[model samples]
Target: MITPDLSGKEFKLFQDFILENSGIFLDINREDSLRISLFSRITAKGFRDYYEYYSFLRYDALGEEEFKELLSLITINETYFFRNPSHFKFLKEYILTPLISERALYGKGIKIWSAGCSTGEEPYSMAITILEVFGFYKNLNIEILATDVSLKALDKAKKGIYSLHSLKLIDEKIKNKYFVPVDKNRFKLKDKVKEIVKFEYFNLIKEPYPLIEMGGWDIIFCRNVTIYFKIESIIRVIHNFYNSLKNDGYFFIGYAETLQQISSEFLPFKWNDIFIYKKEMRDLSLEEKDVNEKETGITEKKIERKSFNKAILSRGLYSKAMKFFEQKDFSQALRKVREVLEIDPQMAEAHFLAGKIHADSHRFVEAVESCQWAIQLVPLFLAAHFFLGVVYDKMGQPQEAINEFRKVIYIDGDFGLAYFNIARIYQLQGEDEKSLKEYTNAIKIFQKSSSEKALEFSEEITSELLIQTCRQNIERIKGFINKKNE
Candidate 1:
């Protein structure tokens, strides 16, 4: 449906309200488009202005149904089947196969959550992927929780109907076997496929996640959800995801996502084209040994392991350096990180920490040098590449930024922020279409990476903040390119 336009004040009011309630920061320049979309809902509600609609939404003794209605109006639900195929491809190879093998070994079931199910295609797709993987293991108990805020959509999903267009590239046999003819041009998922999935309503932003408390899940698919959330909201939701997973459980996000900046507990590993996060498992063996020693009356001395000590010292120095840098104490931060290097020359963390301080202080040469050193210390240091990308971006070398971001993705395919950076650079270079693709990719990754467990360890990604902190960069690039052409 075509949305109606709103007046400037109406646009601002609506934007502010959404930002406050949903933590979705609408770009000021998107006022007109946002106004059109938001105004459509007001019109649908038979309201005259946004203020009235906002008042109604806010003061209607807000409840689940009301919030779901609001979310239905606000959430963008544009999605396609097997859209971004590489992520699913990776899932088939690296993630699903491994999980199936593990489930067989342990004689346990597998559980998956499609956090933003959106009319059921994504979750259905996930179930299909699992089915394809465990074709022989038919007795295995596998289930998918397909949840979304739109009950209306969920209603449609429960009907298990879809247009043929949405089934592009699906194997003929799988389609024939899994879906039964419903009408002239539609199909309903077969009972077998439908039985494996449970449809429900869920809101990522506000949650005591519905099913997570009942049991920990093996994998979560939350792709493309976080692009709409504000930074703080994104962190909160991600932390929630982290807490929801079992130990060593995997979280699958979009091809363009990463948790390196968002959560510390999640250890992101890239296989093929997808970024999956594994929750850190505590070393129960050591704890058990300590308990045993205590019971046996053995004095188990906790010796100061050099590697452990060095990590502690390095982290402390890195923390102090961050504070110094925040206070604009470049020299001191640099000195502190150098001391960290002295303690452990091979510390990539120290190198990255040093690189950040140098980059922030406008010491491009030093920043580049430090970043390069970090990259050399550990070529897979995604943060170092991100920092280097920032340095290049600041130095007015969009191409360089693009290169550095690409390198980051090469090292870690799910590096969402790097995709964001690449998108920004492409936008700067007048590649608006490409930039949009990259931005969407980044958003996709961010959404998929979200989990209850991830949310607990999720913190503000300083690099993301720095990268998106200003609106001036886009305008600056626009003018630069325009003038260059003239």
Candidate 2:
């Protein structure tokens, strides 16, 4: 059965509804995604159109329950054990180790909240790491609270049964020790690991945070969760996470997600190559004190000042790096960029600059690594994608280069230079028809832009210059086609 197409009005209604209820922002680009998610329910309910389904979902007596069903369909649940090994490594070495010692002294338990925990991998992974670090769970006081809005995912998590694909990162010894194979491809987590993690259904945006009565969480893992939220929603959620954390407790977000513009309440800390935020320690007794209270007054100012100083220092170093890059001093540029990264590892632009410098110096391997780091830090980084494409092309990997260029176009449809590069690659591969099509695309995009507008990355090439070059390429490709016909 075909799913009815969602009209723009209906799409907006659903987008608004999702945002209001769950704080998930379905942008204009996600129209097809929204449609597909609602398709099953729309068809199942015998609704002929999207509007009818939306109406039923909004007005019917069981609408709330139905909405939960919709959420299950739409919510992203892609995860795996020990994802981003650096985070887990940091957890064991930096976070858990110190906490174990301190908590041991105080005879208190370690509390971890894995907010937006999908299918239990994260919290379970944490439990595994905790058990490994402490050598056993019997004498240790540890609490792992894993929560998600997706009831379906939580159900699966509770079952503690997983496919081999989900355990891809697990070592053989660890896998054998922590899991019992249920079948050829499935494994059930050992009772020891499962017992520690408590999976619950809690919406980050709508539901009140759990376990606050017990005390603030010692650590919170909400990685990759906030990317779906709007800026305002992210702020609200981060604020809640901040309040829900003990002073000096750590907060982990996805590598691609940064709190730079969102909030400065938490101090950004680097653990090896990975960056995590730390809730600065504060005096709880001074909580009710007025701003005029001298000791407490300076605390807020100190945090702001520290954040300001770091920003200034990183920016200054980045400026120097850019200047060196422009001056063709690759070594100096690389050095300065490294300094920028050392100060602010989350600076995606610095990583991109470092990648560019490496590429310029003909260090393709280093260049690729740096560009990848930049992309991992900021997934939608256009410059990094473009530069990575260029590096791949220089390394004689035409298909890889094309893939990166296509990503640039995907991220920004009007990136005429990406089209131009793709056309050039096709031309080199002796594919005249494909080259002509991409050249035409380049010309069309360039024509829509101001003639004087400089192309991204290739700032020396204006829209007019690119359009003229594309036209020449189109004519050359046509000549090749005509000769083949003859």
Candidate 3:
């Protein structure tokens, strides 16, 4: 039997249904992908058309089971061992190193949850990282819980078997240590690694989290999962994750994902080149106090409340500056930001805001200086680097601008606007191939983002606009390449 085509109206109906049931937002750009997945299921069920399948899934008694099948087919389960090595490195060095020492003092156990852990690679990677760092000491109690919405992925994870493709990043030594060769192309994870991780079916949007009642988690990893979720659903899920975390607990999202505009409860912390969020900032302050006392004999008890009052005053001034900046009142914005800087000279945010004001006022030199100051204060400040690139571009220093954008990418590889800007510069320079590649990269990121979500650091550009522009640029670049070849 021939597969019936999915109409535009039918696509929207299914889109709403999916979002309502699973909290996954299926954008217009993903209609083709959704159609492809639907075709097979439609055929398997011997349905006449897309509408019939949709109705059956929505109304039939077996609808729940069919929906699960649809989820298995549509939900992306692509993962590899040690997919993002920096995250694991940060876990070992910055988090676990200090954590184990602190917990050892208190005789406490460490709990880590890998949310949306597909095929067990991520949670297993955490297991290996923990084992490498602290070993299996009797005193060190560590619990690893991995959960996913897709039962198909969880089943595969529980089996502890993986293909060579999934183990591509693993070194020979690590492969030898943690995995046993099942065949030429398949490997079975050693029991030691598999036993530590407990895999479960968890719907982030639908399920009530019981783990929080058990004294909360020390760490949670929910990487590359929320890209498919609606904005409201994302907010709900993130709020749940926040509650499930203990005071000062660490939370890691996908490198591409951000908590900007979603939640402010977690403080963003950059460790080396990796960025993670912490539930409480007070712990960092206390940790810093301990370090300072070790180096210069400064006691935490000696810290004054006056400094805290100054911080509060500066924050109020910064808010006023941000309002002025948003209104495009550059002079007032500059004055307020300066007041903020006077109160807290080391406030990187104030400096960054000042840079924006200077840039808007066409004072390129001052803009560069302000952005540089912000970078000096916080080396991994992404917004500072991004703004510096914009200032360089305005100054007609494309090379310098490209360098700054590359720095932003080095810090956060999934920054789409950086790729978009780089692509535009390449297009202007007539580097068709490079421009096309960068445009494609930008599209990949922006497509995953919500269509209506306003991009960070941009005045008003949304993900939908970026995706459209990138597609147009890619097509133009391809056309230029074809003409040159002819």
Candidate 4:
């Protein structure tokens, strides 16, 4: 349906409405997204233009429900398990494990909150990380809370259900340990893990401070939430976060966000490639600096800035390569990735991309070499390892392929493709039961509310069609089993 364009007045109306209700400023840049979002519903409800829709949203009896529906459409919920594995790596090796171990000695408590935890992936991933580190000995007092403004999102979080896309970054071990396959494409998080996380509906901008208790939180992950707010509101929210955090409590902001021009209540601590802020001993509300604060501390400023610039260049090239790869222009894609590699040879992501490009062209030896380089630089790189497995499979080294695939599963329990390949190996070996189990696992990962799009063969073989194929194979295997017994 062709939805009408939103006039300036109508756009202003929505901007004001969103700001007044949620403290989120929908500026000129967001007009297109707002227009598209409203258009989808406006046309469905037979409204002609943005003005009519605005009036209906403001005055109609069903305006409230319509507004809720609009919120669901407009909000960004693009998240996956352990979206940034580096941060998870930091959390485990540097921050969490030590803190928990020391606190365990004294039976102290830890409080962690995932602010704006869209569909609960962040918090659930956190729970899985903790489980990986601590195992079943849950002696220490721990409280984990997940909050989001969208009631619909919170409801999904509370239900603890997710698609394989959300679990794409997760390993098969974590999936097997913490999640039960609900069907083809959907997985339900285990009750033990789900019970540890408390999901609540709370708008950061509109809600009052201390939604759970009065401060003293050891860590608060408020990443990507404040980007929607106006500068004034962002300042207020950051202040609230600072006051809410206990002394030396950790505060994590998203990569695109900075405490720079807004607040100085926290000190930025540089982790490799990322920076997390720590609450200072002295209050800085009064001693706030007017200058835009640098993201990293001043000592390593030059090195970090140089590296950041290099990363920017490499990323721009890598992005072009991905676009080329997506369009099936493998040569140009390879060229772009090579440009990235020249600028930063140590870039594991670029190497991974080059490996994918080579693999797509069926140059298995080159693909293997590129993936090996990626593994050398970033050993836990799941994509590189998975692609290496694919390369080995194509090279007719079934055992070698199986070994690499198992490594991916070991790293991320929810990697269904690894299971799918393993099942294929079992089938080749005439192990019907093992093959059926693996195929069932893969099918369970792919069955979802919607069909997933194809991934150009780099990854993600789990789609509705693939799930059906797996089922057919399972049935065929069953037939073979029955005939053999007869």
Give the top-scoring candidate (TM-score).
2
Mind giving the per-residue lDDT tens digits that candidate 2 earns over 1-486?
A: 444677777788999999988899989888887888888877777777777777777888988788888898889998999988889987875567546655654667789999999999999999999866543465567889999988899999999999988999999967876888899999999877899999887888874677655568989999999899999999999998998898778899997899989989898866557788888766644553455356555565466547656765786688789899999999999999989889889776778888888888899999999999978765655667888999999999999999999988775676788899999999999998899999998888788722222164586776778888889888888888899999
lDDT of each: 0.68, 0.82, 0.81, 0.76
**RMSD to true structure for each model, in Å:** 22.1, 20.9, 20.1, 13.8
Runs in model 4 deviating more than 4 A are 1-3, 39-67, 211-213, 283-486
Q: 1 or 4: which has the higher lDDT? A: 4
Write model 3 residue lDDT over 349-448, tens digit each, in one string.
6888899899888899999999999777766566678889989999999989999999877756667888889999989999888888898888887775
Q: Candidate 3: misplaced stretches above 4 Å?
A: 1-3, 46-49, 104-107, 137-139, 281-486
C-alpha RMSD of candidate 2: 20.9
Q: Write the per-residue lDDT of candidate 1 for residues 95-118, one digit (tens) a residue.
A: 565455456445577888888888
Global local distance difference test of model 2: 0.82
Better of 2 and 3 by TM-score: 2
Clashes per model (N, Cα, C within 3 A): 26, 0, 0, 11
What's each prediction's TM-score? 0.53, 0.58, 0.56, 0.54
Q: Of the candidates numbered 1 and 3, which has the greater lDDT value?
A: 3
